[model samples]
Target: MCDQYRKSYRLGRRPGEQGPRPLSRNQDRVEKLATGTATTTTTKTKPTTDSSTANATTTNSSTANPSITILTTNPTTANSRKTNSTTVNPATVKAKDSSTTTKTITDPGRAKTRKPNQTTTNLTTANSATANSATTNSTTTNSVIVKTRDSVTTNTTGTSTRPARITNKSTITITKVPKCKTQKLKITKNTLTVGTWNVRTLWAAGKLDLLRHEMNRYRYDIIGISEVRWTGKREIPRGDFIWSGENSNHIRGVGILLSTKAKKSLMSYNPINSRIIMARFNATPFNVTIIHAYAPTSDSSEDDIETFYNCVEEAIEKVPKKDVIIITGDWNAKVGTDNTGWESVMGRYGYGSRNERGERLLEFAAEHNLFICNTRFQQTSNRKWTWESPDGIHKNMIDLVIVQKRWKTSVTNCRTFQGADISSDHSLVLCNIKLKLKNKPRHNQRYDVSQLKDQTTRQSYQARIEDNLKNIHSTCNLNEHAAQIEKAVKEALQATVTLEKTSKKSWIFDQTLDLTDKKRKAKQIKHLSADSIKEYKNLCNKVKNRHDRTKKSGYKINVKKLKKDYKLATAEKRTVW
Candidate 1:
């Protein structure tokens, strides 16, 4: 027997007296036998190695079983069968209906085959079987067809006992979609406090500490300092101190100090010689550009004073017009209590009498459209004057705070603090302004180095360093070794040292502070009574005497130490020679 007939015998038929039937003949016989039946059955079979023989067997089985209307197997060709029907490839099948349509869809990994009859639609894959509608009785009308990859279900007027069976596994795939997200923002308000002060000198010991104390007392965000008396330009990250001074001598200098908040907002700074230093800050509504200028004193010649103002004007011109410009420091010019012709630049609440230098200041302000903030606010004589002569009898508001006329409203208040004592002739002049600033994060860690002044803490610090260094493994790479050394020292410091708590504490004696306070009160009341005046004079003398004694003592000690160090160095040099 042929292979096609042999497979048919195994499927439940004995190929007894008939050869394998042609696919066309089998389909015709199946239709004739199913003409009177109301039931339809579909059988799915496994594919044989011989594809052509498998298709022939599948067709013969449909005729053998009258109820089976559809037969499915793996994609195969039936050209070997002696049938007049057209050859059907694995991807395409055509029915006998004249209007039947066939479509084959090809995908990268999947195949789709479609077969259509005159009144029914059928869709199939190379490995799946699906039937939309099928009718066993030709008279049956409007049959409900339910198609699935695994089975074929039909709802009609007549019922059948046989159920369609599907033996092949179906594959299913599921896809997922994605979503989008949004962010929220927060709004806030902040304040900017600016000030100016002539510190006289930062060359003395404990001067910077005293300055920090006064700065904290007033809670200043940015402060311009004059007469820093430190040669060369340098930036100290601690408290954000930036200063510019004379190249060869500790004569005149200009500096600026920024608090934690202000330092974070600082964009840039330019040091123009010893008398002028300008800094810019990032702020809302507008940026802030401040020029800290230590103009020539009254004793200076006209040429010197003119040159100072000219330099200040050039600095002012360099600032962008959109920025809020503030020229503050010891201008050493007094634009007295008068606002007649200079009403645009000065107010009527000024201190002392105006001088020739003051006229120059007024002209500069008018030319630059700047408003003198010092004269804009009504303040007491004591609070308005920022400097006091040596005898405590003469006081003037030489230290001035000026701002752009357009942004004068931002300067809510401007005045001086007479109680802030830094052993300087000038008081701290502060200005309050409203501004929004961004909070910058800082990671630098600082320790209280002052603790090392004690012998016990010093020894403990040294021991901790030695232990930490001993624990580090030596490395050949210079960079790695340096990093390890730095880490070890930091760890040692953290173990043996304490964090600095506040910059408010000062080294000056409490007795001196009390005496200074008493002297301030005496000065405030000196004009009220003759006894008060006498007391003020006495207090002033005592304070001056105390300052002189302290200075002489410090100077003598410094000279003695220098002499001793020089002798020791000379003796060591001689011995070495």
Candidate 2:
């Protein structure tokens, strides 16, 4: 093929023969059909070169490394055509000789290189008119000019002009949902140090000062006092003492002292009578109501006892259900150490055996689901008893502080502060409660060292002590000496000891058991002799009968008196109205 093309070109360059004429359209079609390939052929006229240069048609003999071979028949050098073959990869074809140019085509599958001297245009090679086609002649040097028919489309093989349609299908759905639970929240809370004391009677002079001194020293938030003995219902000046008393009497008074912080939280105060007073304070998570009551003695008439409990119950009923209720005072009831049936309201740590009055108090607590704080914590007998007989022999836990069972865990410790003295036979009963408060000054943490008494703990603690002590040196400065001692102790404790709460020990004593055994033996021995048994039984029956008679007579008298007093007071009220 190369030799035939060279012979034809040489013949056409003869002296007078017309320059090589472009192939007719029919011949071009026939050539493409015979090759069975989609190759685009183009032809243009050029001036004839000299015979020597025309015959010098150089072929890129190495088809394996084909490239554009451009030849120019210069009017001055038309006799020479031998030139070097210029190789060009696809996408870039250059026309070096301006006189005449030739571009060897490889694959006309998609596009053709733009003619160097002509405007760039899109090249379209379609298969059966199904591929994309574009015809645009006015293209800039750096831009592609693509003109397409209305139905032009791009097939996968890029051999057709068929248009394609695209569709999309999607679905989304949503419905309203509600929360499973909505919780109510508390914004602030505080740790409250509440205390209660019988104080016997606050009639002595300067006793308020003693009270104030002790309150300041201990930093109690609220303190309930029994037998305050103030004459009437009034707030004490400078002392923040809210007292409730009889119309004309100095006895059976109950009051509450509020610290500065507590007073600031005070909401209202109610004086039910000389024996009972109730106060409410603002707090968080919930408000708190403190009820102070000085119950009548066990010897008092049943009517009086009933009236006192009635007043207390009425006071408690007035408080909102959401508020924390604390009932504290000297109820003069010995709840005892047996918690068999009263487990919900009393604990086994109580001082002495339960008495009749204690039954009433415990019943009240159970009905209200109140926990007797003092009985819940184990303490030494000395600390458990809040009252002592004048003979200094009888000790009883007659005074108690009670709170709702739901908040029982808040009572960290409840015991009598035997050191507090305000001219009172009754020791101060204090209870510690935890509160979650904002911006509250945290209390100094205290650790109980009693765990060091255990054998294993003692050995470990001793070893730790030895280790820390080895790092210490003799110091003369007082501060340095104190600090070194403290550091050694603290590190030793941290290394070998665990934190434990300081609860009181059991109040049961060996002497108490001995005395009880002696009494039981006396009863059994009394049956040994006929005369002695008769005398003992007779005396016991007489005492029991006498006590029953006295109680019946006292109850009847109280009923009559109460009715008369009620009539008189009602008449007076009617008259005044």
Whose lDDT is greatest here? Answer: 1
lDDT per residue as tens, model 1, 396-455: 899988888887887778999987766577998998877765544445677888988999
| Clashing pairs in model 1, backbone N/Cα/C closer than 3 A | none
lDDT of 1: 0.65
Residue 185 accuracy (lDDT) in model 1: 28
What does candidate 1 score on TM? 0.49
Residue-level lDDT for 100 in candidate 1: 22
Q: Report the Cα RMSD per candidate.
A: 27.8, 35.9
Best by TM-score: 1
- Report lDDT (CA) for all predictions: 0.65, 0.60
Going through the candidates in the order shown, the clash numbers are 0, 10
Cα displacement (Å) at residue 107, model 2:
92
Give the range where candidate 2 is weakest over 10 consecutive residues by summed lDDT.
166-175
